[model samples]
Target: MNNEKYTLITGASSGLGKEFAVQCAKMGRNIILIALPGGCTPSLAENLANTYNVDVRIFEFDLTDSQELKKQITLILERFEIDFLINNAGVGGTSLITETSMEKIDQIMQLNVRSTVLITHMLIPHLLQHERSYIMNISSMAAFSPIAYKTVYPASKAFISSFSLGLREELSGTGVSVSVVYPGPIMTNSNTAQRIISQGIKGKMGLLSTAEIASTAIIGTITKYPTIIPGFINKLNHFLMSILPMELKLKMISRAVKKELI
Candidate 1:
């Protein structure tokens, strides 16, 4: 009902997550910031609390662990009503499919896909209570193309992209909006991971600032757009892929990955 009861962001410790927290504060929104136990630096959180002049509650938990997930939410609800849920916590795991271990793949899926899905489900009731609420899932341009070496990561995002789209439809007319953000090579830790992935397909151009992407996503949610692909080139890439044959698309993606990493 008020700024103090609004805006909950997961992975609020750094990068896009941190940027989202700051932007929400600027909007005078009270933020429920969730991050891995050590993810958000104490200094950063205190600064946000000082600058925004709004209540900033920090929750630290391991999202991949279901038990911890619930506990964190329980603690959060003890203080405020949550309106916006940003499922932004994720990790970077890269390796060729054959070369990647199952343990690594499972870890990637757990954090990137399952945890995100679970947290969203857990917060639905809270969102429903608000006159208007939003859930923004942070996906990647990798969801648009296959990354051979980084098989699991892209696949996880693809799941999120599809999931968010389906959810947007389900929540339609419910006063709870869902927006999926497809950000290309954001200038964050994820981009750093891509650099290790290889060369020709390596991330190039000016990576969009985390603040820019966060602002765009937040604005998109406010405007109730179901799917938002930020950046001109990313939109172009999605357009190109949409019409391409499946085999050709796969081949193109494979070649790009090879060039990018090799």
Candidate 2:
């Protein structure tokens, strides 16, 4: 019997996903990095293997493609017994919903909602096989409210929040702890950085680096925290949102996000 376990992280090529891989490797856990076909996961796997001296593997598959996702994920389960799952691959942008093409909307829903749900669904049995296991879903602070330009994105993340909390209860006492992370604006890439910079102070509020977010998320997930809103400022933001009227929050958030279209 193999006693070794693997932490499987989607979007492991860069950003917060990359940070998750790094931090988990630092924790001496073997990793299985999943990313798109042209990703940097191969080199990352090599570096982590040498630097942390832990086993690292890479699986490249576009999660948005339901057919490919099914094939690849099934193969992954058959080959590796991954006890930790991180559903981190997601996409969003600031554009008017009318201007957003059907293709674009489908992509967001597929990658953000469908893929995450499918991957988590397929992996649950494998997860239950372990004496103890962890599942961390990366949601967003955007999930707390509605925004105009980035409509579908927030809705998808809200689903993740609902799904995570519900699954946590369902798997309660079963040793499979499900936790969701709500991260504020992350400077994960040049495009994202530009977008955040464009928003000035408002965007900067509750900001945390990928390393900080990953560290906090990992710690929370391991300790079985059902919901992780990293950073004090983020917690404050959550509090503020909780108290605000939905109608006003929507208008404010919509107005702020409308600037991104310019």
Candidate 3:
């Protein structure tokens, strides 16, 4: 095994994934960034390497392709010692279940659920080689409650949250630590920012910047925090939502989403 440690981050071209790459590089950690094919990750890799003076490598591939993903990651593990795995690649959509096409649903499941699980599974042996390792999976606060117009996305995230928690327990005695992050709406891009702004006061309540979430996630992972929920308002909202009856929680979320769908 290579003695130098690196953090492998999926979806590192943009959004929270990009922020995580920046923060990790700032800490002087070598990085391996994976983004979808055709993304501008080469430039990002160059910038990080030059700015932080850390080793940065970029991989562009379809993460949803399970066979190819496994093959590529197997090759990666052979060449580098990855001490941290950040599973931040995911897709989200808002639409009625019936209106969404089968392809879109499959994409969400394959990328968000299948890829995350498969990559983690493939990397466990490599992680175990290290005296200390960390895994941080990005889940959404939507996992807390069922909502209309976003049926599959939230369910997928709930799976991530549960999977991370269970894996954390199973790997307890080992040197590896697992952390699940549940972040609310993040202003990742101008489009997402506009959508949140359109929601008026309701949107602002749970909105968090990508930098804040990334910083908090990195800190939490390094310190071995089991769960990382970034903002105080988001934590409060999660607490409030958790105590409500399931039916009530569903209804409350439905009402809010319905307004957005209109």
Candidate 4:
């Protein structure tokens, strides 16, 4: 086994994934950065490798393609000792259930859920052998709510949140740790702000920069926090949402969805 600890971040070519790659490198972690084929991150990988003076290996594949992911990851694990796995490759899709197509839902689930499950499943053995290991799944505040227009996206995040929590429990007795990041309106291309704004959602807020969110997530994962909700307001919102009655909460959320993003 390779002795050096490398951080493996998926979707690393841009947005939150790219930010994670840079921040992890700054912390002096060797990085296995995975980007979609032809995505922006390959060039960024070169920059990060030069600037941070950390070993950077780029893995390029379409995460939604199961065969491609398995082949690529198997090849990389032959040589890299991954200490951290960030299950962060995801896409956003927004449509009412009535308007959504099966094809779109499948695509979203394939990348956001199936791909995450498969990668983590494949890497668990390697992670188990590490003295200490961290797996961070990027969920969303939508995991706590049943979103309207953006129906399938929230469900995908909910899957991530539940999977991370269950995995955390399963790994409790071991050195491997699982962390879930529930970011609210991150200022990334895949975010609520765009869909909500375009739909005229009322009282919606601006989002955190990807760098800011990624920094917080990295800190939480490194510290082995079970869950990290990035912003103060988002944290408070989650706390309140947890206690609020479901009926009242759903009504309020439904109104907001119809008013803003629908």
lDDT, each prediction: 0.80, 0.92, 0.91, 0.84
Candidate 2 per-residue lDDT, tens place, 138-229, comes to: 99999999888988999999999999999999999897999999999999998888888888799889889899999999999999999999
- 121-191 in candidate 1: lDDT tens per residue? 98888889889999999998888867677888988999999999999898888989999998877647755
Decreasing lDDT order of the candidates: 2, 3, 4, 1
Sort by TM-score, best first. Answer: 2, 3, 4, 1
Task: Point out where model 2 deviates above 4 Å.
Answer: 1-3
Query: Which stretches of candidate 4 lie above 4 Å from their native place?
Result: 1-3, 190-193, 196-206, 259-262
Determine which window of 10 residues in candidate 2 has minimal summed lDDT: 1-10
In angstroms, the error of model 2 at 200 is 1.2
Task: Estimate the Cα RMSD of every predicted model relative to the unseen true structure.
Answer: 2.3, 1.5, 1.7, 2.5
TM-score of each: 0.91, 0.97, 0.97, 0.92
Pick by lDDT: which candidate is best? Answer: 2
Task: State which candidate has the highest TM-score.
Answer: 2
Off by over 4 Å in 1: 190-202
Cα deviation at 197, candidate 3, in Å, is: 2.7
Residue 218 in model 1: shift from native, Å?
0.9
Please give the TM-score that candidate 3 achieves against the real structure: 0.97
